[model samples]
Target: MKYALGPILYYWPKKQVEEFYQLAKASNADVIYMGETVCSKRRMLRNGQWLDLAKEVAQTGKQVVLSTMALIESPSELRNMQALVDNGDFIVEANDFSAIDLAKQAKVPFVCGPSVNIYNGSALKLLVKQGMQRWVMPVELGRDWLIRLLDECSNLGIREQFEVEVFAFGHLPLAYSARCFTAQSEGRTKDECETCCIKYPQGRPIVSQEQQRLFRLNGIQTLSNDCYDLINDQASMGGLVDVLRLSPIGIDTIEHLEAFRQQNDKDRPFPTPDTVNGYWHKLAGIRQSEDEA
Candidate 1:
């Protein structure tokens, strides 16, 4: 199937963000998602920057999708989401219900980001009615759950309306909150935090006293300790999944993307997971089970 580069979750400097897109444009990703899906305060590359980049990359025959923030705090954020929906050029990935409404009102086809709750067929039907073109599978759910959900959608007679994409790489976005954990970790209140997350390009690691990674802290978002990998599980997605999404992480992300693009090659080697796999096999998300892949 096709490959998609998920939006950057970390906050990098404006120049670095620009440079990253240049690399992304030359990469093997068919679809590239860009925007600040994490803390809004880390506005190194704002919405304008994202749209401009989208246009620049789209010219190379690559599709671009602008992603909205998961947690909308103020009216400004809502306004930004509305603008993203009304952009009229690039596709927008709705990370929240407010964005879904905006896209519905704009009559713009959108993608339901993995953060949104789309557990069953009924919900899928409703979103399809709202002009959703693609639906990203939630990171927590496993293969069996997806099978049942697709079956339900098929029974509803509307399974063909949208493409299915999976989070095939990177740290799983577990949860989001109004509270900025990164700020808290630095002993600064959310308002007085001074955008401390900018210091962490890939987010700060929350390690246990035993020097084991417990979780990753990024503003209000709580990420999995170990980066969840599912490249080897691509075979299972045959006929079921249309797109494989690789979330941006590390300096060698382009190399990883190329490796995933050539996943069908038997001689091609896959990147080793920093820690372990997630719930794709219905096991503990953070469990580094030696018995499993």
Candidate 2:
């Protein structure tokens, strides 16, 4: 299966963002997704800069895709989505319904990001008609759900029309809101928050009363406390998934990508801590199955 570097969900400094993509340019990633998928206030790299970066990455023979924001709270954000859809060089990942509409209106092939709720075969078939070339399954759905969906797709004779991608690694994005949780935690309003999400590159962790990590708060997105790891679960995805998406978290992400590329032995022990594979096994998203554990 092809490996895809997903969009950075956290707000990172411009230099760090550029450096990370530099590593990605030389890494084993077959597809690279760039742009802001979270809050719009995190503008360390504007739309023009992201487009430039996409062009640079495309030079390496890797497919580049511009990802749209998951939550569009204003007309300006909608216009930004329109601009991304209008980008003639590369395809765009539509994270919201508005973005999907924009891509459809522009008559360009688009990827349906995980944030878009495409749950059924009918939805997938209709989107194929609208120029959806790829579909990244939602993080909450498990293997069983995918099996059923693909079966339905095969029954409908549209299974070969689009590629299937899964969020294989990184902290699962659970939800998004209008309020910026990072700013709220800093005792500031969303408007005057000063773009403080850049302070926590991996996002601010939220723990329970007993100090157990529960979730991560990144600007407006709520993510799982544990990283969802499926590096060792490739056997389960052999024929089902076309691409495995790995979200960038830190500098070590390049190392993980290399490991994923060279992984031939399925018996190797999982090398990371605070990781969960339960979501792939139809269990609680936060719990790791005994076999995988």
- How far in Å is the alpha carbon of 14 misplaced in model 1? 1.1
Question: lDDT tens string, model 2, 1-293?
Answer: 89999999998889999999999999989999999999877788888999989999999999999999998989988888888889899999999888888888889899999999889999999999999999999999989999999999999999999999999889899999999999999999999989988888999998999999989999899999899988878878877999999999997887897787767356675576778888899998988876555
Task: Tell me the tens digit of each residue's lDDT in model 1 across 1-293.
Answer: 99999998987788887888899989988999988887778877777777888999999999899999898989998988888888889889999999998899889999999999889999999999999999999999888899999999999999999999999888889999899999999999999999998888778998889988878998899998788777767777777899989888865787888877677555444656455665888888886444575
TM-score of each candidate? 0.95, 0.97
Q: What is the TM-score of candidate 1?
A: 0.95
Candidate 2 local distance difference test against the native:
0.91
Q: Where is model 2 more than 4 Å wrong at Cα?
A: 291-293
Clashes of each: 0, 0
Candidate 2: residue 183 Cα off by (Å)? 0.8
